[model samples]
Target: MTTVPRRFEILLVAGFTESDETPPTSAHALRSAVVEATGETGESGYPRYAGNGMEADIDPATRTVEALLVDGAEIDYGLSVRVVAAPAT
Candidate 1:
């Protein structure tokens, strides 16, 4: 089994809330939300944020976001994120 992390593109969906309908506008915000929802941390004990989009490291064997067992929902912003696709190996 490989221990290296693979790159995967993530999808972020805006969920409906009683008071909020605005979706996340920046990658930073999405990254923060993902970290809050998944509670995932890197070797330095901090959430890793990729470039400008919603991209993250996913275990290729599992092909799932770590700590995000459910449909990846963040209650604060009512944002839902998921692993959409991985780059061609």
Candidate 2:
């Protein structure tokens, strides 16, 4: 089976809040859950969203992080982002 890269276009990100008391098992799980929670749909046969490398710092204080960068289109869809967080600089 071909391995899907850790990077893909994030089509949508829905705002949500989960009980932080319930800890995530692994970093992979956390990332996957977050991506799924975003409500992203990588649908084919439609205008597919593309990923842009723009990113923001995670702030535990703010409890909110900037959404991923997606190719801006006039259509009604939201932004897309990389599936995995970019490597630390």
The estimated TM-scores of all candidates read 0.35, 0.22
Error of 2 at 15 (Å): 10
Worst 10-residue lDDT window for candidate 1 reads: 28-37
TM-score of 1: 0.35
User: Using TM-score as the measure, which candidate wins?
Assistant: 1
Q: Which numbered prediction scores highest in lDDT against the true structure?
A: 1
lDDT of 2 by residue, 1-89 (tens): 54223333232333223544432232423122222222233232111223343232222223233433323333234322223433333
Instruction: Name the regions of candidate 1 deviating beyond 4 angstroms.
Output: 3-5, 15-49, 53-76
lDDT of each model, Cα atoms only? 0.42, 0.29
Enumerate residue pairs that collide in model 2. Answer: 10-80, 10-81
Model 2 error, position 79 (Å): 13
For residues 1-89, what per-residue lDDT tens digits would candidate 1 score against the true structure? 55434344555555534475543343533443222223355444434435332334444455444433223332345665555344454
